[model samples]
Target: MAKQKIVRVDYRLIHGQVVAKWIKYHPVKRIIVADDELKNDEFMCDIYKLAAPGNEVDIISIAELEETLNKKDDDVMIIFKDIKNAKLALNSGVKLIELNVGAVQNGKDSYFVTSGVALSKEEFKDLQEMQEKGLDIYVQPIPENEKLSLESIKNKIK
Candidate 1:
């Protein structure tokens, strides 16, 4: 792989922060979405592609992504729709040094995780597993704002 860009877990695949800031600010050449769900969903796939106009977005399944190994630049960002899917990709030999916990949705027994993001018990469990594997997980919505580091965010769990 030329580079192993960011591995972010976001329910919403593409957003303004992703296109405007992460892609433009950091200047990533490609946006790789490694999610099996989105890979199969035609509507979501179309949405992601259309949402990122003038941006190179590759939506690939975990199996397909594992066989590939080339980011071609330092600015590429690898994103996943959920933590579980991203975990699968990472275990498949994708080196993700930094992980961005983009957002979590509201649900029963869930608590406020970060700005506009909440986590249910099941989601929290997946997050704990990622932390155990030593991935730097943070809850940050916008790139420009101050971010919540892994240590700081983890402290809020227990």
Candidate 2:
């Protein structure tokens, strides 16, 4: 199996920070945005592709991601729009050792977890399950930021 260098859950999938910072830090040849909604929207997918100029960007649905990952031999960074989608990918047999939680927009039911990260109770439960599954999940918007663990966030919520 090809290595999945980074599996990140960022609300803004392929933004300036991702292109300028995360890409450089991870040094992956391919960037895969795994979102069901984006897959069906060609115009949006094209925009995301354009955002990452040098590297190859593939905007694929969660269903197609598993197949795409299987055929790739290069180091790939997979980005999900939310933790639920990341959990879905994991349930579908995607092997991810670590997950970076970034930029989850604030919602009515969501609580602020860390810088650029907010999660509802349900989402937090999904994250807890992922952690139990042996995935190292942390909240870090950028490489320079401190990595906040799920345990710390859980304690804060309590």
Candidate 3:
């Protein structure tokens, strides 16, 4: 199986930060956006594909992640829209070693953990669960920014 280079939890699956920044800095042969809802939506998938013109982009359901990654022979950056989806991927045996928390939406009851990361009570708990399972979790909104540990911002949560 090819290496799953980077796994990230970003609310915006594929945007300027990803196409213009992350991809520019850490070039990957493939980008897999693992989202259940968007996977089946052909129209939205096309738009995301267009966003990254030259790269191989696949919007696949969480169920397909393991098999897809196993079959591919190139380095990939797997992205989940939120922590829940990332957890789902983990529960399904994706073997993710580390996770990068990016711009999650500051929804109701969510606390701003850092510049671009916000977590509600439940979301923080989910991250804690992942951390307990030996997953290294950190926050870095963009490539140029410094990575912040999950423990570093625990005080931000109410």
Candidate 4:
């Protein structure tokens, strides 16, 4: 198995949007879900499994992420349900991967992740850390909605 190159954070997990967009956009072969809730939730994992066709999608723990996939230089897209786990995953060997913020609706107003998806205080801090680490973080829609252009995102980053 090869290493994953892209890491996405979507509260919704695998669904129609992800299957149709990122699976093809990044040409991803493996989908790794780094949500502890989903990692322990078998039923949720099953639901995610059904969404993906031929691709291998594993909902694993933040701990298992590195050992399972030693590198991040291949065709893989990692999805985390929250920023904390996403940062922990980054603490592993992951680097310079494109962060697609899928959804974080439950976050507080102070937490900035685009104009839409909310973020918790901790989540915001984690994102700041990830930024400090030099990860490429961007808020892109699930393809059904209007695309979020680089110019627009640059404003949010400022």
Candidate 5:
């Protein structure tokens, strides 16, 4: 099985920071984006593929992601666009011991945890449950940024 080096929640699945910064720190051989919507959108998938020129980029559904997690042998970085998909992957048996929160676009009822990350009450609850289940969840937009744990952001959640 592939070593799951990083599991990041970024609304912009594969972009500049991922290619120019995160990869510099993690050096992943494969980038698997686990989002049902992206899995069905060929054009968007192609864009992400172009963003990460040399690496193997795959936009797969949550189910296919589970299979990939079970069979692959490379160091992989899994990206989920939303907390729901991340929770789906976790429930599907993807053992993500640590999850990095990047940029999640603001929405109604969402509270800002950081300039880049905001979470709604429901989303915050989901993350809290994940944390309770042994996931070390934190917010770190880039390699240079200090990671802020869920506990630090708890009070900010609306």
Candidate 6:
């Protein structure tokens, strides 16, 4: 099976950093935004498409991620809107060895782990679970920043 080149969670999916920086860094032909809501929103879908000028941007529901991966052999990056969807993709059998956490906004019971990342208790737990499952998960908002492991964040919060 052809695996995704990068599996990332970024609330602002297909933004400037993604189009300008990430695609250049990884050189993926296709970028799949796996979000349940965005898949049904045509306007947002078109907006995301336009954001990535040269590459193909596909807005698919998280459930469709595995099937999409199965069909594609191209270098691809899968971006999820939240950690839950990323976890769901893993649970649903999408193969991912590492997860990049980026720019998840403040939500219920959430606290800032970084200026960009805010995780609630449950979200933190889910990340811990993913890490325990042997996934090398880390938070890094951009290519220039250092990737912070679960342990690093945990120590910071303590």
- Each model's C-alpha lDDT? 0.72, 0.88, 0.88, 0.70, 0.88, 0.86
Candidate 1 ranges with C-alpha deviation above 4 Å: 71-74, 154-158
Instruction: State in Å the error of residue 115, model 2.
Output: 1.5
Worst 10 residues of 6 by lDDT: 149-158
Number of the candidate with higher lDDT, 2 or 4: 2
Instruction: Tell me the tens digit of each residue's lDDT in model 3 across 1-158.
Output: 76877889988888888988888777888999999999889999999998887889989999999988888798888999999999998988889958999889989899998788889989989999999988999999988889988788888998
Candidates in descending lDDT order: 3, 5, 2, 6, 1, 4
- The sequence of per-residue lDDT tens digits that candidate 2 reaches over residues 89-126 is 99998788699998888888888878788788988999
The positional error of residue 7 in candidate 1, measured at the CA in angstroms, is 2.1
Predicted structure 4: lDDT: 0.70
- Tens-digit per-residue lDDT, 1-158, candidate 4: 55566677787878777888777767877888877677888887898898999888877888888755764445777888876778777887655356767687663354454545665655656666777787767666564555453345444432
lDDT of 1: 0.72
> For all candidates, what are the clash counts?
1, 0, 0, 1, 0, 0
Model 2 misplaced stretches (Cα beyond 4 Å): none
List of clashing residue pairs for candidate 2: none
Which one wins by TM-score: 4 or 6?
Answer: 6
Q: Of 1 and 2, which scores higher on lDDT? A: 2
Model 4 misplaced stretches (Cα beyond 4 Å): 1-3, 71-74, 108-116, 143-158
- CA shift of 74, model 6, Å: 0.5
TM-score of each: 0.83, 0.95, 0.96, 0.78, 0.96, 0.94
RMSD of each: 2.4, 1.1, 0.9, 3.7, 1.0, 1.4
Supply the TM-score for candidate 4.
Answer: 0.78
* 2 against 4, candidate with superior TM-score: 2
- Which model is ahead, 2 or 5, in terms of TM-score? 5
